[model samples]
Target: INTGAIKSEAASSMEMTELQNTESGEIISGNLHILANSTIDNKGLVNVNQLFIDAETLNNQPDARIYADNATLNTSTLNNNAILAARNNVSISTETLFNNKNAEIVSQGNLQIAGVSIGGALTSAHQVINSGGRIEASGDIAINTDELQNLNAGITTQWVTDSIERIIEVQPEGWAHKYDVSRFPLIHNHNVEGQPFTDENGNIIRYFEDYTYYDYTAKTQSTHIISSAPAKIIAAGNIELKGNVLNSDSQIVAGQKLNISGGSLQNSATPGQKRVSYNGTRQFRDWDGNDEELDFGGIAPYSPAPKNTEFNLGVSLFEDSHADIKSLANIQTMTLPVVNSAMFSLVAKPTKFYIETDPQFLDYRDWLSSDYMLQKLAFDPANTMKRLGDGY
Candidate 1:
């Protein structure tokens, strides 16, 4: 427009005689086109919130340019032949440019601009030349279908089958062997140092090359000593000893049963310093009656009598049979009247004698008679004469 000022309030179209620089400004509805070269000066803002430009009839020239600031361009159709051109510096912000169809450009010079927004897809069949400026969009930027297929065909091919066969050839053939202790000596015989030798199928094979003699004597002795050792005495049993029971510092008597009838047993003491004395009577009365018979079944009475003598006596019973009193006759003739009264009057005498006053006599009779000696003597006293040493 060759006017200094032109403004339109509503839908109106105007035709200009010659497009020229306006000092004030120019505004038009529907569309605005400048057929000649024009400059938009500083402090001159051109805002088109919804505007469309048609370059189909312009022959796509390189000399054409459109300068707008804080303006928007909304195009409805974007065909392959449609074009957009911007002159010098075009700073667009707070604006949007949408294209419904494709766009193309044929330019040689650089498009020097800043902050331009595109709101739709941009497709280009030919090359896009951006020498210095930046073009940004929120949507996809793609090439045309024919150009896309040509780009994909330029990629090189790979031989996947050959790569897979090479991988298979280099892979290991067997599984790993694990270490264990239960298969020790046998396992060590087959090993090459410490690692196990494996077959092709990953199974361990006995190679028998690394055999070294193992001193089993020391190992077996150590195990036997450990298993045979006794536990420490946390609490003493009923049995107590008057002196140190251990023979020496190196050995221990583990299997013996100690009987503490009257004294305390000392684990570490001098010969008689740590003596254990009788705390109570060795021969306890079965009941209050002193005439109570001693049961010789479990223990022999600690009384001065024959080995097989059973007495109707109590806690006043005699000491155990000593070597001096060797027989029943020796016991009967002793100075102790209690011994003769208890032995001769109360208990019957043994008809057969194995040995005189021998502790082995009871054991011998028990073994020979097979547990019937006590029963036979108690029930039938006359049976003693027939059996003799061999009880019936």
Candidate 2:
């Protein structure tokens, strides 16, 4: 029961039934193979410089546990339901550390804790890698880099949701500021309809006010047509859209060459009004007529855009075709002619398209005239009604 000196030279080949009351300080330098049921309990410590377990003799009945300051287990095969729990440091390396289809090793420290599991727990702090294995742990799973030469090694981890909650913090300071009104002082006190007027603190002050004007006789004239001559229109931050912009066939396309280098370009469709319909039972269906159905019932069903009803058209010039856009639906066709020394032209025919230009070209006015020309041709009464009636 109380062995002062315990040594197993060929312990890797032998089997251990039960190892108890080794509190006298037992030292195991060789492999400690547990072929049958074994338990090292009563707070007894089995100090092993190195340990090994045979893979062939592992079974459900034989479960091994070691309480030691530091222990190393190297094995090619492990039986099922083998629990190797260490109080301090535990190191294990095997072709596969598996037992009863589930093997677990746990190591807990003050600064960090590590574990590994093929079917169960195999814990270590220095290094842990699971190639084609699964690991379920409550603590962190990190690589052992002290002895490793390469820094970019692959590591897989499956941590509990509770652990992620503890590690990741959601601070108020991390919240992004949506709009900053101080930059645009003209927009501060302006009572523009539907334009968001915010104070210096980025808080919205006045929203869209729906008030119709009876005698709102404004200038109703077409945009100035400047032949084929180029013009320029620039903005500091962004170009936003509030209402639907449609062509003759109700299709929307890019008006001009838009460039925004610093700020983000976004497009958001206004949701339609919801209409409720009652089924036979108490269940009621709220249909906004905005849900888009995709036909993929043969293999699998996947609809990326479910609440999109309207289509969009985007037209970019040869110079501004590569701008970043938010969304693009079905593109029809594009025509491209070689310019300068650039190889192959880029063309896209999109049903619904959104383009984001660079901000650096905002103040640059070379593309503005082209934009105005396109807009004038797009909205002219003579051309507008014909284009709309033609069913683009």
Candidate 3:
């Protein structure tokens, strides 16, 4: 258990790695491997060339930082509060993971997280998985969980737009003074019917005449470029939620396809309420304005029931993934307000599919017309060919 500050010179490299710090610790190593039961408390820094931490539970506190060329953290529980960055790949496997308070786990290469519950802000040059934390990747993003709650975060893999330019010279009239005259051998040899140029004496000259033009105009050769790679976000689970706000922070934007296989997707401000109906004769509706009444038509009615008898059913009003109700009925639906631009897919098998959008629904047309979204969103097709800055 290291409590005091451990310092190493820039040239130094420690080989061993087993950290159980109570408060603070720092390791500067070439290659390190942290065994089980290791914890990095506040202000801890693990900077190494390669790091592999196979611990029971690895908790990186708010001020902690871990930097490496490549890292692999295999733990039962991983609670990171600060940053875990790597130049190459960063693979983290855990049963339970919590990346709280805007914590970041970034990788310049690929990143993979296999866990039961995942919550964090993850950014990678390749692949990643995240919850109500911002997930940005250049490649694919695959997340398989039991339940996902992205209250106020986004998953985006925007297009990669870049441009190049070259300078072109424009001449008004005559050829330049430095023009090569060797090609016109007839003018120099005086063997053709008409000489290239006449001398001052109005006689054909053996030598070619110089144009003597030095001034030339220069113009920019601009090429507008628009390209995008295949970026997909596949979120498969029982339930998923990507906030109800209309801001950019809650959007799920993919360059290519956004495939979501979930039992329910609640995207509205108001939760989808469920209604209870006793028998086929009597009907009880959801108290909320938009109630999805459940039909118990096939099932038998309550036996020996009083006038106001209420049988306790093991189901919550907002729990859409009720095992009993889900098996009996079809509740696989998506409540998405804004769907625009890219290709979108929702997989709720063996049920009549439907999408419930907000009253004030917005699509690509609205997104392109909005001043705020125009300035904020990436790769607007309307301005794809328009020259705005130094490069398009």
Candidate 4:
């Protein structure tokens, strides 16, 4: 039948067209074959067992969806900005399949299509597309479109029809969702439906890559960037870092040179690894108010050393990654704080010494004895002493 809208009706024997939204309607079951062009402008879900569409053109809306077990379309053009699913296989032999503008697909079997501008994505056990097809995708993509390899993948949609005609080419043995600009080619596909990632086994996820030259003027003051994975910047040209660039695994690789004429590439500043512990350095207020009689009357310990003397100094300092920084500009020679920011916690105590008073020269008891020369009377009647500088 050739019509715009189609609703199935009961039939005696029809297996492929048992379609129904809710069970409230009549048990209509029939098969239909479209011979001319058709457009499904629906917003609800459509489920069918098998469908054979030989229409000249198929135009689907934004929220429309057509699901079937196996679908074949020999149309001239298939502009699908909606969803199309098939449980078995989907073969489109159209001249051009503009699966752009939010078009999505799911194939439980295999999918083969020939097109020029392929902006949408398909999930199948196996997907094969003809050459000269530009595809933007993530997750595992087994593609053989090497004819359009010379196209430069710009970082936007402008790369789609750039006269050279850029196509989102997936690397061999690489998932479309795992493109690392530093290690692999830049993922210049934008607005692809397989992005905003998901963990579904049959989904094509999206990844990110940094641009070569990012600019910042007075108008662009504060900016915050958040990513699901580590951020990387790989440039064949120059880069100017102006503000604070923070990342868990932030890396910047330049092929030839980089021009950082202004702003610094300094990391977060933290205090050095240093600590001090006072040993036997506590001071008391002479609680009993008797300094000379404390040794005899009280049981407290006393030292003959003066108050200005140092008792002990326990300093614990060690070298860190910052100390190993040989040069600030020569990033290759020295270690980077980004790689070695984690410090090891350890304590190295200082050596403490105990002075002995048992020797004759150091004995305070001998010096304080009454027989010593210091204990002799200063002015005596029978004292015999020479004047100063005359005799000792």
lDDT of each: 0.23, 0.29, 0.42, 0.32
Model 4 pairs in collision: 9-29, 134-167, 138-176, 138-177, 139-176, 139-177
**Taking the tens digit of each residue's C-alpha lDDT, what string does model 4 give over 1-392?**
11234457432332232222221222212333544434423344444455656554566555555666666655555666556665566666565455433345445455545333245542221112111112211111122221111111111111111122112222212333422223322223234333344322555445322212111111111111221121222333333322223212223333334333222333221111222211121112111212121112223232223212111111111112233333232121212232110011122222211112212112122333322332265633224232111010
Stretches of candidate 4 above 4 Å error? 1-5, 9-31, 37-46, 115-392
Instruction: For candidate 2, give the lDDT of residue 111.
Output: 11
The candidate, 2 or 3, that scores higher on TM-score is 3
lDDT of 2 by residue, 297-378 (tens): 1332221221223223222111223445554434323343232111112223232112322111121224343335546766
**What C-alpha lDDT does candidate 3 achieve relative to the native structure?**
0.42
Worst 10 residues of 4 by lDDT: 153-162
TM-score, each model? 0.18, 0.21, 0.37, 0.28
Best prediction by lDDT: 3
Better of 1 and 3 by TM-score: 3
Q: The CA-based lDDT of model 2 is what?
A: 0.29
Worst-scoring 10-residue span by lDDT in model 1 = 217-226
After superposing candidate 3 on the true structure, give the runs of residues whose Cα lies further than 4 Å from its correct spot. Answer: 3-18, 22-24, 38-42, 116-132, 153-251, 261-264, 268-392
Point to the candidate with the largest TM-score: 3
